[model samples]
Target: VDFPLRGEWIYLRSFGHHPHAYDFVKIGNNRKYYSNGNLLSYIFGRVPANIFYCWSAPVYSPVAGVVIKANDGWPDNKVVNLASTIILWVKATFLFRPAKDGPDLDIRPNAGNYIMIQSESGFIAFMAHMRSGSIKVKTGQQVAEGQAVGEVGNSGNTTMPHLHFNLFDQINDPYQAKVIPFVFRSFERRNGNNWESVQNNTPKIKGEAIRKQL
Candidate 1:
């Protein structure tokens, strides 16, 4: 619970858009948590083509742990509209495996490209849907926070390119992960230049926006 916030480059959007809207999942309306379960690389904003190919950037380590699972060969799927959710799910189920870290899965077997950090707090951090062959760390290798592990990408059962990040108490039973609420040691809010701190934060929803000090 006392670790540094790992993500900075990526902004967020659509917080708490899913059913489990909460401080850990959504700040207002933006979906803060990863579709599969990894911390994001960027926040949601009008970055132009950034949404499509932006995830190719590297993902940093939230904590130090060995690489438990990773797969990056999969490609990003197109974003889905509200009406086609059922059809998407059906197709995904037939073609992909369920998300290993949550009940509502957005990842598949091998979890695309990912890294698992076994925090000193006895928590395992899972970052998934990484770019193909972008992983920098290896299994059993020790990594430091903010260490480059892989690039964000759309893979597995994900709809687009985005880092799926999460902290798990156990890697074996990912579905039982207890969403740990946290904040950054230093970040700006509302575009302020000063480095500020945040806690128990969620992402901004559609139509709502906020800026953080980077």
Candidate 2:
């Protein structure tokens, strides 16, 4: 598979060998700094969705496939501060209990707005945390590889803006499906102030900036 977005981005939660908390091997991409390498462009205050560089950036299809599911209409949540973020995490972990077998497909909003495309190889490519109403394709629509499908957003149970990409075997019951490992064909990695080119590498560390080699 190819990198889904353009420009420099940081990989947050990526696993190469096994699935993470949700039983699906997912990759979370985010762009925190601006072009000038400034981590924070403005003084710390209420961080809106626009402050994040990856917010609303075009998301492309990683593979040629048919859109099996295209869900939207979820409002993007506000960006919370560090303290509030910790509290929210604590509450979600201790106070509120989630379903052990995963959320029901009919009522679960865990992924917020998302798109799932079944590739020609029979693997379903899932993209989540998309901007509300930004999906460009519909269910049953065929999409070519690298085609624009949506934009990254700060939706769902996220503290900031990011794109969550994953692959699953079962389309109807995604949480119960087996995760498939995949790698980018070509990409760039962060090396201090410079971006280094890498091929067939799985980005798994936080603060690691990378971009699609185009």
TM-score of every model versus the real structure: 0.58, 0.77
The 10 consecutive residues of candidate 1 with the worst lDDT sum are 19-28
lDDT of 1 by residue, 1-214 (tens): 2222233433443223232221111122232433432222223221222244344665667665566655455654444333333444455546545653454444554356666777766767777767777778777777776677787665554444555665656756646666564444334333333434456564444322233321
Error of 2 at 86 (Å): 2.9
Off by over 4 Å in 2: 14-45, 87-104
Task: Predict model 1's lDDT versus the native.
Answer: 0.49
How much lDDT does each candidate structure score?
Answer: 0.49, 0.69
Q: List clashing residue pairs in candidate 2.
A: none
lDDT of 2 by residue, 1-214 (tens): 8788887676665333244311111233333343222334223445666566666889899899899889888888765455555654455444543354334463224566889899999988888878888999999999999999999886666556778787887767645788777888788887877788888867767556677744
Model 1 segments beyond 4 Å from truth?
1-53, 76-111, 191-214
**lDDT of candidate 2 vs native?**
0.69
